[model samples]
Target: MNILEVNNLNKYFRQPTEFHVLKDLNFNVEKGKLTSITGKSGSGKSTLLYLLSTMDTDFDGSINISENEIKGKDNNWLANFRNEHIGFIFQFHFLLPEFSVFDNVMLPALKLGKLSKEEIENNAFELLCLLDVADQGKKKASLLSGGEQQRVAIARALINQPTLIIGDEPTGNLDSQNTAIVLDLFKELCKEKGQTILTVTHDEDFADRSDRIIHLKDGRIVT
Candidate 1:
């Protein structure tokens, strides 16, 4: 089954005139597949992730998730859908410095108010354990190492049990060893849990681990 479908997607930024970022991009990601989107700096890889995650709405064309078109969904519904069905990991960890690692992971569940406090804590702890960071859960995010912090972010992203997990340069900040560790974790999760993932990266090593690679040049697919 296809989990995501983007057809003839076109996104333009208007500075003075229209400058296109994505041009007639079309792609489909199947359920339980780990896919990579790779391109140069000026390419629309991150923009595509934002659009797929419903964080950016300034675009033209159709994006369907489970047969529901994104264009027909209201902002309120889209926000809810993203929170409930999608998990995001950006290059920056985006963890609140003042919060404990556990709290940061549980933040999504807290904001949605769908899970009870006890349930949220339980889920958060389980995710932390899964990521091998259970012992650091009580520590402040600011105290953890770069890799530890990224793992915490991953745990938090998984807290909601999202079917689609999107990561933009998630391992960009890590060293070679840490990068391998994190990449392996994502690979294991995708296989063991049957989660669909769409990741954007410039790292060839990281991109090679994916089941399929989508290469982009100047905002268009080249391979």
Candidate 2:
């Protein structure tokens, strides 16, 4: 089953003329597979991720997630859809420096108002434990090491149990040892939960671990 499908996708930004970030891109991610999108800098990899996740809507063509079309959809509905179905992990971790790691992870569940307090806490704790960072839950996210911080970010992303996990350079800041640890964790989680992951990374080692790799070149798939 295809968890995500993008067809003839085109995204352009207006500069002096027009900056074409993605041009007629087509791709699909099957369920329970780890897919990597690799490209050089400024090749629209992150732009593609943002577009698929509904973070940027200024584009053309279709992006279908689980049979639901993204283009031409209502903005409000798309926002809600992303909140309920997509989990994002960015390079920066994007954690609230002031909030405890537990609270950071619980924020999305609380905002969606879908999970009970007990359930939300349980899920958050479980994720942290799975990542081996449970003891840091009460501490501010800023206090954790780069690897630990990203681990917490991963846990926060999974709190909603999103079907599609989109990661953008998630291990970019980590050292070799930390990178290996995080990469192993990602692979283990996908198999353990049967989840789909689509990640954009320049790390060849990380890309090698994915089930499928879609290479991008100047906004198009290179095959």
Candidate 3:
């Protein structure tokens, strides 16, 4: 089944001048699959990801995820929908420095309020274990190494078990070893939990290993 669909997407930037960034893009990402969006630096790959994640709403066309049409939705509605259905991992691990690793991971679930505090804590611990950061749970997020911090970010992303995990250069800051770990983890999530992932990456090996690679050029899919 398709977890995401983008149809006739067009975006523009009118700041300096009217410049078209994305042009009539369309695609579908299947459930339980890992997909990558790749392109040259100016090809709008990241813009596409922002749109797919429902964080940018100034584009034209329809974006449907898990049967919900996200285009035209208000920011409040989009924010809530995103919390319930989408997990995001950015290039920078945006953890609260003052919070413990466990607390950072549990924040989303806490905001969600769908589970008891105890249950959320348990879930957070399990996610930490899955990411191989179980021992860091009691440490301050700022105290962890770069790779460990990224793993903790991944754990936090999974805390809510979002139907789709969207990543923007998720391994950008990691060393080769940690990058491999994250790539493997993404594959595992798709295989074991039927999770859908859509990531924008410049890492060729990362894009090549995904189930599908949507290559863009000059704001259009070239493949």
Candidate 4:
């Protein structure tokens, strides 16, 4: 089944002569599969990702996610929908330096308020363990190495068990070893838990390993 559908998407920049970025893009991402979106710089890969994440609304088209039409929703509704159904991982870990690793991971769940504090804490610990960062749960986020911090960020993204995980160069800052660790983790998430992942990446190897690669060129799907 398709968990995401984008139809007739068009985006443009009004400044400096109304440049068109994406052109009539249409695609469907299957449920429980890992998909990668790849393109060279300026090909509109990141722009497409931002739209897919529902964080960019100034576009023309329809985006249906998990059976809901989300393209026209207001920011307030989109924010709530995003919190409930989507998790994001960016190139930067973006953890609060003063917060403990556990606390950092628990923030989303707390904002979600769907479970008790104890339950959220337990869930965070489980995710941290899954990411192999459970041992650093009590440490301030700033104290961890870059790799460790990334793992914590992943755990945080998983805390709410979102239906879809959106990543933008999730391993961009990591070394080779850490990159391998993250790649394996994403594979495991797909194979073991049937999680759906959509990532925008420049890493060829990373894109090669995903279940599907949606290659874009000049704002159009090339593959």
Q: TM-scores of the models, in the given order?
A: 0.95, 0.96, 0.97, 0.98
Worst lDDT run of 10 residues, candidate 2, spans 49-58
**TM-score for candidate 3:** 0.97
Tens-place lDDT digits, model 2, residues 15-100: 78888889998888999888999999888888898898887877998989989888787889988898889999888999999999
Error (Å) of candidate 4 at residue 33 is 1.1
For model 4, the stretches where C-alpha displacement exceeds 4 angstroms are none
The C-alpha stretches of model 2 lying farther than 4 A from their native spots are none
- Cα lDDT of model 1 by residue, 51-139, tens digit: 88887777899999877788867889998998988999988999999999989999999998998999999999998999899999899
TM-score (C-alpha) between model 1 and the true structure:
0.95
Clashes of 1: 0
Candidate 1, residue 178: CA error in Å?
0.8
lDDT of 2 at 79: 80
Give, for candidate 3, the lowest lDDT window spanning 10 residues.
Answer: 154-163
lDDT of 3 at 47: 86
- Model 4 lDDT tens row, 91-147: 999999999999999999999999999999999988988999999999999999999
Candidates' lDDT values, in order?
0.90, 0.90, 0.93, 0.93
Cα RMSD of all models vs. native, in order, equals 1.2, 1.2, 0.9, 0.9
lDDT of 3 by residue, 99-160 (tens): 99999999999999999999999999888888889998999999999989988988888888
